[model samples]
Each structure stands twice: as structure tokens, then as C-alpha cells.
Target chain A: MVPINEMKSKCRFAIILGVTLAIGNFFRVPYAFSEPIVFIANDSVPMDSITRKELKDIYTGKTKLWGNGDKIVLTFLKQTDVYAYFLRNYVNKTPTQFVNYWRNMVFMGKATFIPKSIKEEDKLMEYISSTKGAIGYISSNKLIKGIKVIAVK
Target chain B: MKKNRMIINVVFSILFIYSAEVDAYSSDTVINGFITQGYMKTDENNFLTDTEEGSFEFNEMGIKFSSAISNNLSIGIQFFARDIGDLGNDDITVDWAFADYLFYNWAGIRIGKIKIPHGFYNESRDNGIARTFIFLPQSVYSDPWRDSLLTIKGAGFYGYLYGLSYQLQIGIMDAQTDGGLAKKFNDITKSSIESIQPETAIIFSLQSTDLIDGLKIGGSVSKWDWKMDLTIQDMPAKSDDEALLWAISIEYAKNAFLFSAEYSIFDVETPIDLYVSPTAAPYRLPYATNNVMEGYYGSISYRMTDWFEIGVYHSIFYSNKKDRSGKDNVKYYNWKDYYSWSKDTCLTFRFDLNQNWIFKLEGHYNDGFYNGYITDNIDKDGNEDVEQYWYLFAAKLMYAF
Candidate 1:
């Protein structure tokens, strides 16, 4: 049984080391994030970058007040794909099309509910350092220190 | 009994209008809502209404509401309580009542009873993670054409720039037909009638999420115009009857390899027929004529881990009843005979038992004509082949505020 071309060269080096360890464990089973990808806000929220789709439609309550009458509050994550690819690349959609257009703006009652998706970026930076007209996005390596990082288009 | 005491006084006036805005002092009057209940089982030849053996239904309640009314306006309402025959009794309905205006985060506008943005499940087709199967895709989004009850009274426009999103809509109301079976096949057409005219509609959608990286795609189109009493000589009869719809949907999940799908089509241009067994002696039977209908469906899902994943779906429908006048001469026009054609099928299976539960199993096979009348067969050729088969099971539970 021995030399059959050295067992076909050890089965072609074990099929190229099992396809290079199954593509190196299919992308090394970790999508970065040991923290630092924050965008807390409320440092007197003067946003820009197409106002990040009006700050993700005022923290997902679909922009209720805030041409300076403040009143938007949101902090989400808890279902990562890098938090739906940074709000589908800051509101251009697709994280299931911005969760199917906010589940059709929350079943057509036009707004309310949909933002408070968590998964400990230190408990969403301790509720965005004790909430207050809060806005969110974290994991540029969990950027702690009293969050604030706006600027996305 | 007074419509179940006016649906228990409109569900205690929507729970005393959200507990009087949470006992006032809630500044910026904001109150949210979401509650859905489900459980359904049906087997006996299932294809909408094909009763044969397995039967179980729950789907007890549904709700949606939003309030703000200034600071750029807002107001909304949605309600449902279907499936009343299992002591899980219900039939309440409201469906939608809207109003919205923004003008910032990329423009906004919405007006009463709206939705009818036809396809891609008519605007989130009553959420549940926007679709993971527990029903929908019945040859293109369930419960017939008036998806999410088409709402309408008109007005819509929503925008989002950069990542791309655009929607435009137009409306006009009062239009009904689809499984509420209407019948009457000549003797010069008559047998309980109604058309409630003035129905107009339009919808458009466009979407993109910055070119792939966990994709999202969109496509939508809709058309509706009805006004008819039945016309053919010189044509201008006006109960015009029209329908044209389109759809494309996609969703991709990252890291765990999840996927989603949707495809749709429906075209109708005036078709209706009704007649059944006119008394065995050349009975002049089976009539419920409607020509030109179309359908399509496709679905794919994969998760394979993270609380198990599996999915499959397929659908098809095309019964626009045509007789383009090549007269197959069914015995000297057996009362102006006209049969339709199209293949029909449905298949589905899904299970997700985590993050708030879900489970579904589906199977269906249809060959056409159930309520649009054909009385199980007569006349040997109005496209006789009303075959059917069905089985369904569903379960759902979700909670989050």
C-alpha cells in the first residue's frame, strides 16, 4: 500500500491544509470591535455630514422636534453587523433597509419605538453617560470618555 | 351586539389614550405601541379558503399608534384583531389613520389612511422584523390586493439622501374586490351588485444602502383605477378596473450569513365572471369571468447558526382569465364561454426560536377559481381544473419596548 506517489503527495498536502483552515475560520470569526466607534452627541448637537440623515432621524423617533427645540434621544446597537453597518452607512438604508423603513415608521402610526438596541459597549457607554438628548453609535473601540463624535454622510 | 360594544369602546379608548399621556408631565407627548399575537394551523386543502382537515387559528391582536401633533406634526393609528372562531375571538379593525410632516432628515410628508405603496410587502406589511415568514408572499404579499388595507385618502413623500431612499405616492379611496366573491354570469349580467367608484392610486419606491456590504435593494410600482358597470360596445364604460404592480426586495445579514428575498407581479385589466350549474339541462354554468391576472414569488434565507435557521419559499399565480375570442366553440357559446389559465403553487418553511420566538410551516397548491366563482366545475372549459391542497402552521411571540 505504501508509495502511490507518496500517497498522492499526502493527499495534496491534506487538500491544501483543508482549504487554508476553511478560509482561516471564515474571516477569523471576529469583526473587530474591542470598542471605540462612538458618536454619542449632545455636546450641543450641531451636526453635519448631511446631518447624518438628521442624526438618524432624531435618534429613530423619526425626527420629532429639533430644528433646535431639542427632544430626540436614541442609543442603539444590540444586533451588530457593526451596528447595521453604521446605520446602513449613516442612513442610506439597508440593515434590512433601515429595518424596513423603521418597520414602516412603526406600522404607520408614523413613529415611536426602535432604538435602544444594546450589547454592552460598557452598557452603551453607561447609557451614553447618563442620557440627555442622547444620540448613539459606539465601537471605534468603544470610545468611552463622555461620548461625542458626529460627522457622517 | 353593537359590533361587540363598538369593539369594547375602541379598546377602552386606546387605553385611555395611553394613560392620559402617561399621566401628563411627559412633555413632548410621545407614546409608542406594538403588540402582536399569533398561532395558526390549517391543512384541509389550504389556499386561502379550502377547508379540509387541519384547522387552528389565533392571531388575537395587533396595534400601532403614534402622537405628537406639532413640532412638525405627527399622528397615527392602526388596529387589528382577526380570527374569531377559536374563542380567541376577534374581528376588530381600523388598519390606519395617518398624518405626518417633517421637512428635515431628508423631507417628509404623509396623509391619512395612506400606505398602498404597493409591494415589498406594502410598507413593512405589519412588522415582525419586517418579514421572516409567518405568512406573506401569497403570490406576493398576503391578504389580497388591498395590502395593509391600502389605506388611501392620499398623500405621501419620504426622502433620505446619500445612502438613497425615495418614495412618492398618490391616492383616492373606496375600492374593493378580491375574495369577497362577486357572482352573476349573464341573463345580461345581474346578481347583487356594487362598485363604489372613485378609486385612484399610484406608488413608487427606490432604495439602496451605499452599494453592498450587507446589501439592501428596492423596487416598487402600483396602479389602481376603478369605475365600471360592465362595458364592451364602443368601450367607454368607465368602471374601468385596472391593476398593475411590481416588486423587488432583498436583505443580507452579515456574520452568520443570513439572507432574504422577494419578487412580485400582478396585472389585471378588467375581468369578472360568475355562473354555476344552471340546472343540468345545458345548465349554462360556472361563470365568474375576470381576465388577465399574474403572480410571482421567491424566497431564500440562511442563518444556520445562532438559534438555528432554515427557510424556503416559492409562489406563483396567473389567472387573468383570457378567451381572446378564438372561440373554442363550447357548444354554440354555452352562454358566452370564457375560461382562464395559470399555474399556482406555494411552499414555505421557517423556524427561529430565539430573540422572541417564531416558527412556520407552509404548503399550498392551487389551480384557480375559488370565490371569483366557478362552483367547483361545470361547462367543461372555463379552464376547468380547480385543484387544491394546503397545510399551514405558524407561531410568534415578541416583546420589546
Candidate 2:
């Protein structure tokens, strides 16, 4: 048999441990809380900022060409967490819904290109850096060299 | 065997050309396709097929490929096959093949076979998995007009101006008389149409998507000229006509709810010449008249969850808007089986079994005898045996990628 004070102390410790674990789990995935950062090819793209609506239009294939008559190449991170977060906030759609929209567009002969999806952050960055007219998004903390961070108005 | 050989040859030729083009621009090439199969049955009348005894002869399959040739030019092609009872007969044909060139963010041009820009859903009508219902509102999207309005061989100009998207097309079309529209004319005239030749066509559409976050309001107008040749008991006659079709549509989709409405009218002016057999009469008959068809539908859908959705719609169609009641048709034609309109109420449910598979079920309550496009509903004596009221059920399974 334990004393009453010791039992109370043990119970308090267990509660604190559970809370700590929950908080840690919630923040363990950077996508859950971090805002997505928009990026473009530093050398090819001349635009520095884009409106949220313009971004949405570009992602949805509504805006196919940029101002300089260059095609807008789109790239996407395939990680489910970050992709879901970006779709929900930027496009006002779920990941599945966004995919379905593209599929319908492609099948109906409305759009010719589907965004390139890359699983690794490094690979996405590399592709954007190497390709002209390329644009993509990453987590806030994953910003790398050779890519321009554009502000979403 | 001949059809199979032709299909194989076409497939191989497309593959060879596509591969060579891909090798030239290997960076951005994508391929996708879908398959759908459906079953339908009606209690009394055949709707689109032999549905009175239940039928599974409705299926659709398509394959599409697209590639970017340059920064501002891209090309795409799609091959489609379908069997809607006796309509498609499992014929594989070119759905659309176009080369798109973008001059500016606001303007572009597409050359080749292009999809017709009609109502909101007309362009994507073949994509079953993307829609909430297995069958769209039939009043506006009549089955008989599907083949005639699917695509046009010509050029189109598309652009965005002040937040409004517009598409204009000018093309040539060859009309086929085996479709539903021709059948309806035959039923009315008691004649068999041998051929139809389409002279020219033009279509224009304008849609605004920026008024609200998820709202779209649009209108479309299409006009065409056609010449038809008919045979009535060994007597031949020719007729020429001009048809004008126009529609207004509005749709709003936000969150888990979607609402849409559309109204359309088809006006036709034709000169008809009628003649009886030599044994019956040698005198000419006068049966020329102008015709107008009008239809409208309103629908609402709610997504209960990520995987489930339900929708309902009420649609109404009139063979002649001026004569909303059948009294004029019955009196003028001296026919007792004439019906001037159809009113249909439909309920649909959809389940997304997974990301790539979808299942849908639909039920319809119909009133009137306007649904005679399906040949099975007509009697062997060339008479129509149709009930004034009926029920129909349909189910479809689709796999898309």
C-alpha cells in the first residue's frame, strides 16, 4: 500500500507525461502547423509576388501562361501531410478533390499538363532549380538556395 | 473481323506517332484513361435502351494522351468507345484531338477536333467519375443529340476577359440519321430518313467564375444548317432546315453542397414536301411546320462525407414550347398518342469506394410519353405503345485514373 501523497504524485506524473506526448506528436510533423512557402525558379521567373487567387488559378490550370508568354510549369510535393495542408489552405479543396479536378480536366481535353509530383524535398528543389518556368511550394523551414521565395498576397 | 483489324491498326499508328513525338519532347508527357459500365431498367417504357427487361449494354471507355511541344504550344488526343444499346455499337472513334497555342494568359487558340462548348456539364459529360449522378439531367442533355453535338471539326478561340471565360467555335459537321432526333422525326412523319448532311455550325459560350468563390453563370448559343432526305413507302422527299439552340446555366459549389440550374430552347425552321404512294394518291401533301423544343432542370447535391454523396433533380421537357399541352399536337396531327412534354424527377446516390473506383445508383419517376427514342419501346407495327407514367432504376460502376 502506498501513501496518499505518493499516489497523488504518481497520478500527476502520468497525466503530465501523456500531455507531453500528445503535444510532441502534434508538432512532430512540421506540416501540421507550418505554413507552406511558395517558390519559383530564381533565374527564369521574374515575378516576385502572386495573389492567392492567381495562385489558385495557376494550380487549377485556369492560368496556363505567364505574363511573358512562358508556360507555367507546376511542381508539387507528394508528401501527404504537406500536400493536404497546402491544398486545404491555398486551393480551398481536399487533396483527393484537387486530384480529381485535374483528372477530369485532362480527360476532358481541357488541360495538357499535370503537375509533377516529387516525394523528396531535395528532388523537388532540384527540379525547380533546373527547369525554366517552374514553380513549387515547400514547408516554411525547408527553404533552400537557388529558389526565389514569392509572397502570396 | 474488319472492325477489329481497323481498331488494331489505328491503335498501333497512334502509339507509333505518339512515341516518336514523346522522344522529341520527353519532359512532359502524360497518359490517362477511364472505364465505366452501367445497368438500367424501366418499369414500362424503354428510356435509352431495352431497359424494360433490364439491360447492361451501356459502357464507356476512353484513353487520352497529352504532351507539350513548346513553352506555349501543347497537343492532346483522346480515343473513346461506348455502347449505349444500339447506338455506339462498341465503335472506337477519335473523341478529340487538338493543338492548343497560348498567345497570352487571357487568350488562346485550339485547332482540330474540339469539344463543343454548351452547358456547364456538356464538355465533361463523358467523365462519369467526376459527376455526382450516373445520368445527367436528360431534359437538357437529350440522349438523341449526344452524337450530333459531341464535337466539331474546326477551330476555336478561347480566352478570359474581365474575369469572364469565353469560347467561340466555327466548324463543319456531318449529321447521322440513326440517332434519337432522327427517330423522333420519323415517328412524327411516318417516314424513314435515309441521310442527313450538315452544312455548317457555330457555337459561342461565355461563363463568369469570379462573381462568387464557387459560383458560375454562363450562356451558350449554337446554330447549324442541315439537309435531310427521307423515303416514305418508295416515295422520296428532301428537306432543308436551320436549327438554333441556346441555353442559360448557373451553378454554385461550396463546401459540401452543390446547386445548378439550366434552361434551353431549340428552334427549327424546315420546309417539308410530302407525297403518298402511286396507288394511294398522286396529289402533293402539305405538312410543313416550324418546331421548337424547350427544357429546364434544377438540381441540388450534398456530400455527406468524403466517400458518400446524394443528389436530386427535377427536369421538364417540351417538344413544342408553344403547345405546353398536348391538345394542339393531337388536334393538328389527328393523332391520339401524341404527348407534348415530359416531367422527370430523379434521386441519385454515389459512393466513392476508393480513390480510383466509384459506384452510383439512381431512380427516376417520369410522366408523359416523350421518351420514345429507344426503339425497343416502339411496337413492331410502327406504333408506339407507351404508358403515361413510369419508373426507372440505374446503377453504374466506374474506374478512373
Candidate 3:
């Protein structure tokens, strides 16, 4: 009989391999963590390239309290791998850690929230079209009139 | 405490306005909104006392607006109104009003009266287009028939990366099922399900479609606690009430096949000791008041050479919560017999009228008792047990923009 522990370890390895292969077969990573869609507040904040690191820092609360003294407004597409990529590429934290971190920070009275954290590309477009200080992103294919797209670092 | 909360909310609102101005400078104005209406009639289903039928009625209307103040900063606000139909008066309420700042898509914060994102549905529960039916799977999503008063007032961060979303919130808020008004719309203060309490809750969800087109799966877990003052049976006490909820759901649709299901479990802790009796033998004071709720429904619609398509669905709900000691019960391991369970099953047939409208006829069967231990003794005539059964028929017309 195959050693139980070794067999179990082999089974686990096979499962991991299968899952990884299956995932690899199904989804492809986006060109960057930043969504294809972008937004602008005023002329002072140039409509230009954003470094992935700076983007991550801003989102993760490492860089709280904007120079303008306003709390950062964060928006997100509801649960999607794009969010995972953004978290991994920029925030350098797992989604669970990120959520826990923010919850802890908010409890300490150190942060505020963004009004709309939408998943649908259309809704993200709508946010980009109306709000002033609102910065959001969506799929490139979903792009339409009113919203702007900035470059990623 | 009340005055302090009011002041805090006021202060946050002011801060939001200031940020809004800054956001206006660089952010483009974005406007978004949706409208949904549902019509249905039910005869002797769930907890409704009477059977009634109704035509199409406007169920929800809402608008959300946001703007990016700068490349790294933004703000957003949302306003919505709902019509609960016969469950109560035709009332309108602001569903969610908040401001957010995203330093990046990876991280941001939200403040104001927030949707206490505790499950997969908390934030999107009001969006009608997100679900196929007029009503959601009750036991798994909205248990104890209470949700309107469950939202919170506070601030937290919301972030998404790769394929996950997260939310954490803290505040002094009202509890559901307590029969008090904790939320306000303009000047109208509606009665809430529970009295006010300080609360802390967290939500984390993960989803992926990159693995397969038109298929998504995710899970969420939440825990919250509330402070309560209750007087049951003329006994008064100050207590802490807590509940933990967990759920997992999956969705897949391609061509004509669509399937979705969600399962949720909740454990509630009350504040009372045990009292022994036959029908009311308190199972476990300071024990485990546990309830498991779940629902799954799958449907298929074939193009069938255009013009028309037909679909059928089945859904089930079950709740097992035995309340023995009223408000002062703890989940002690002793009293296990006090728990009871109830089940509701439904079947639906729907017909499509083009891309924007559909008509459905549905029926529900319910086993009225909370626990299987209770015999169906409704008839009392001794010939047969009167089990609860009902049907709902509805026609809906929707326009998507």
C-alpha cells in the first residue's frame, strides 16, 4: 500500500496542479492592474500616467490624507480577479488582508469611504461622468462618452 | 450618545462636501441610475397573514453619482427610494448615501450611511436587475424578515484586486427586529426592527470569471454584535446581542443555461439563563442558538427561434431557530431540544416577452412549524394535518437603459 502520508501529499499536489492548470486555461491577466478606464478631478492633477506602486500606496492607506487634506476616495469593481490583481500588483496584500486592514483603520477613525464602489462597467462609466473628485476605472471595451482613460506606470 | 452620533454624522457630511468640491475640480461628472418594478400576488405564504394578489408595482428607483477630483482622488453619492408594497405602507427611503475616496483602484474609503456589507448581497440587494426573480431566497439572504434597518452609519475602506471585494464598518447603529427607528430619511423616521446599538461588521468576497466566461463563484462571512435593553415577561436587563453569518454562492450562464445558489448559516447569542418546561424547556442558556439557511435555483431559457423563450426554476428555504428564553437566552450547551426548523419550497415558470419583459407564475409550499418535532396540528379536526401552501402569479414589464 502507498504510504498514507505520502499519498495524501501527492493527492494535494495533484489537486493544486490541476487547479492551477485549470485556472491558467480559463482566465488571462490584464495588461496591468489598473483598469483601462481612468478619471480626472481638476487641471492641477494632470491626466497622465499613474505608477502601479503609487496607485497601490494610495489605495492601501499607506498614503492617507491627500496633500489637499481630503481623504482618498476609493472605488472598486465588485469581486473580480481584476481586483485581486490590483491588490497583488499594487497593495501587495491579499484581498482578505486588505479588507481587514481597512476595517481596522476605519474603526480607529483614521479613514472615510468612497460613495460608489460599483462592479458594472456602465456604472463605473457613470461615476466617471458625474462626480468631481471621484476617480474610478472600468473595462476598456465598456468605454463610452464622458469618461477619460489615463496611462499606468 | 445620540447627540454624539448626530454630531459625527454632521461632521462627516461637511467633510464630504468639502471633498466633493475638490473632486469637482479634476473629476468628470458621472451620473448613473436604474429603475425596477415587480408585481406579484401571494396567498398564504411565509409569514403573511392573508392571501392577496397584486399587479405590477414600482419597487425601486435610485441614482448614484461620482466624480474623480484628481487622478488619485474621487468622491461619490447615491440616493434611492423603495416601495415595500403591502408588507407596509408605500414608503420611500434613501437606501444608501455615502462619499468615497480611492487613492487607487486597489484601495479607498467610504463614509456616511453605509450598506453594512456583511454578505454577497448586502450592497446589491436593492438592484433588481442583478437577480431574476421578484423576491430573493429569503432564509439564506434576508432571515428573520428584517433588512431595511440593518444598514450602518460609519466609515471604512472598500477595495478590489484581481477578483475580490472587501468591506469593514463600525458605528453606533440600530438593530434589526427590535421595533425602533434608527434610520432616518429627511425628516421621516420610520420604525426599525430593533432598538439602537453600537455595531462592528466585516465582509470579504472573492469571485472569478477569467476561469470561465459567464460563470462566477464567491463566498462571504460576517460577524456583528449589538447592545440591547429588553423587557420580556416584565423582566428588564441590559445585554449584548451578537450574530455571525456566512454564505457562499455561485452563478453560471451561457447560451440558454443559467444556474445560481447561495447557502447561509447564522448563530445568534442571546442574554438569558435556562428555565426548564415541557414545550418550553430552555435548551441551552449561554449555549448555541444555531440556524442554517440555504437556497439554490437553476433555470434555462432557449432562444427557440427568437420571439419567445421559456424557463423554469426551483428554490427552497429553511430556518431552524428555536426561541425559548425570549431576549435573555444564551447558547449554553445544555438545552439542545429547544431548537426547531421550518422549510419553504417554491417552483416557478416564466415566459419572456422580448428582451425587456417577462411573466412568471410561481407556487410555494411551507411546513409551518419551526422545528420538525412539532406536529402539523392546524386542522384540529383530527382527520388531517393542515400544512401551509400558497401560490404567487406575477407579470412584469421592465425597460433597461
Tell me the TM-score of chain B in each candidate. Answer: 0.28, 0.89, 0.65
For residues B2-79, write the lDDT of model 3, one tens digit per residue: 453355346445544554454422236544444455566555331221224344443555445555565545455555
Tell me candidate 2's TM-score on chain B: 0.89
The recovered share of true contacts, given per candidate in order, is 0.18, 0.37, 0.00
Tell me model 2's lDDT, rounded to 2 decimals. 0.76
Q: Worst ten-residue run, lDDT, model 3 chain B? A: B182-191
Q: The CA-based lDDT of model 3 is what? A: 0.45
The most accurate candidate by TM-score is 2
Off-target runs (Cα >4 Å) in candidate 2 are A1-42, B1-29, B275-288, B332-338, B379-383
Candidate 3: stretches off by over 4 Å: A1-153, B1-37, B45-50, B53-58, B85-88, B116-119, B143-150, B168-194, B233-239, B272-313, B321-387, B397-401
Candidates 2 and 3, the one with greater TM-score: 2
lDDT tens digits, residue span B63-180, model 2? 7888878877889999887777667766778889999887887789999999988798888888876678887887888776787787889999998766688999999764568766
lDDT of 3 by residue, A72-100 (tens): 45566654666565555555444433553
lDDT string for model 1 (B342-391, tens) is 22233334444544344545443333332123332333564533333333
What lDDT does candidate 3 reach at residue B336?
A: 26
Assess candidate 2 and give its TM-score to the true structure: 0.85
